[model samples]
Target: MDFKLTEEQQMLQETAARLVRDAYGFEQREAFCQRETGFSAEFWQQLAELGLTSVPFAEQYGGFAGGGVETLLIMTELGRGLCLEPYLPSVIHAGGLIEQLGSEAQKEALLPRVAAGELQLAVALEEAQSHYQLHDVLTRAEAVEGGWRLNGRKSVVIAGHSAGLILVSARTDGQQHDESGISLFLIDPKSDGVRSRSFPTMDGRKACELYLEDAFVSGAALLGEVGQALPALRYQQGRAVAAQCAEAVGSMEAACTFTLDYLKTRQQFGQVIGKFQALQHRMVDMRIELDQATSMAMLAACVADQPDSVERSRALAAAKFIIVRAARFIADQGIQLHGGIGLTWEYMLSHHAKHLLMVARQFGDDDHHLQAFSALLDVA
Candidate 1:
């Protein structure tokens, strides 16, 4: 397969990079870090104006009709800029889940709003102890007269405070973590008994711990059957992990460029620091890992749409593992090479480092992906 990006992808990449630099520069980013919402309304509106809200949906669904490739390009650019927006979780995770699993009416009602960026959605799936396990859900969902009553707590819910709709995971049967009990729900965040408490994240994104005290949901809230939500959850995991890899590739690339220029220009011991043998080797090491991560990210992006679950999972896990390992090295070495300046908030290297750290924590750590890879096949 030709790995080259099409003309449109390249153009979109450049456009997104420029928009992020222009709109979300250091001062603006710092402002977001201090704000209660941790997201810019103006920026969100600008994204809506740019039609970014519509990229992954089909044209008939009021979207730009772009698929995984287009979404990947946009996400890469967003990562390159170290953007603090919630596009991937809001659009890709929540929106894609809706597109993939929601019933016809469910899709029609919510997707158009998602496409237009009018309604923001967040996934309230994670529990306290589990690490990206979809089938091990503990949130309980009981059948009511007309629909269902959802009573469970969700941890690490992305964009929970700002979302209009929440794609929640709940247990309908069985006590322990098993396949039969877990299900997905699309409930209003504003519904009675629903509460979202904001937690300050390392990155400038508003994540929350959600409490659902007898939250009522209609039959339309059911995203898919209890047994089928795992597939959708897996798909969501793939998109998130792939997007993190893309972001890491972009951020690490920028970090490399920045470090090289710093070394080349800065003088130490009567010569340019970059001329030092140790630093040159460090740069080479960074390049090697960065390129490997880049290649794996592209592979995952390409195969993310494949119908075969094993092929997709294997590729996705590989991408996630490689990116986590390489990005950690690059981020650590970048900060170390920058000396004390990297430790300061005034320099953006530290900023990028923190964001990269957040990326490592996103779907799961390197260890989690390693185990995930092992679990992919029961065979030796």
Candidate 2:
């Protein structure tokens, strides 16, 4: 596949880079993290105003109907700045699910608002015991008179504290760990029987633990067909994984830049450390990893919007596995090259390193994807 960016894609990348550079200074990012929402509402609105948030949705809902390449462009820029916005959860994950599965009325009521940045959404899929398994849902949703009544706890729900709506997965039919009976429900976070405990992640983003006790959602809240939500959930998650790989690539790029700059200026013995052949070789290794990751990220983006198939799944898993390993290597090497300064909170490289580490853990760690790839290795 061709790797060249089109004229429009280049323009999108430039716009995103410029906006992030102008708005996401280190001090500004720290200030945003101090807020209740853990990100800049103003910057999020700026993304909406600039049409970045609407890149992947249908034009009828005020979106650009752009595809995976567009998402790659935007997410890479966001990763560079380490922007703390909920774009992944609100726009990409939840919005994609709605567009993919919502009824006409549901899409009409939600997508426009989401495209306009009027609504924020979070997804709750991980339980205490689930680890990284998406199908290990223990949350139960029993059919009630007009809708479903849900009861369960969701752990480490990214951006759950500030979401107006949350998409939750629960077992409505089969036993735990069975993929056949899982269902998706859109729930109002402020409704009765729901509670949230908010906290900051190691990388400065906000997250929450959610509890549901008889949480009621209308029948309209069901996304896709009953007991058939697993396929869509897994499919959309692949898209998310691809986008995250792009983000990690951006972060890796930043880390490499920071380390190279440090090596050039920092004196050790009689000369700058960058002059040392050993350090130079290490930097070269980091660059090689970064390039590999960038290629894999692009490959993942190219396939993110394709129809569901074993090939798609295998490609995504491979992308994620390679990217995760690259991220971990870059993060560790960046810190090691920088020494004590890299660990300081005041420095941007430290934050980038932390973000890279977090990226490895999200979606799935390196091992998780390796196993997934192994399982689908013979599909071709």
Top candidate on lDDT is 2
Every model's TM-score: 0.96, 0.99
Clashing pairs in 2: none
Worst 10 residues of 2 by lDDT: 371-380
> Candidate 1's residue-wise lDDT over 1-380, tens digit each?
68677897778777677788789787878887776667787888788888877877888888877766777788877777777778888888898888888888888888988878788888887898777677767788999998999887889887888888888988888865777667899888878989888887775667999999999988878988865687778787787777778878888888888788889998988999998899999999999999899889888888776674776897898899899888889989998888898778887777778778888877888888888788886532
Report the alpha-carbon TM-score of model 1 versus the true structure: 0.96
Clashes of each: 1, 0
lDDT of all predictions, in order shown?
0.82, 0.93
Q: How high is the lDDT of residue 59 in model 2? A: 97
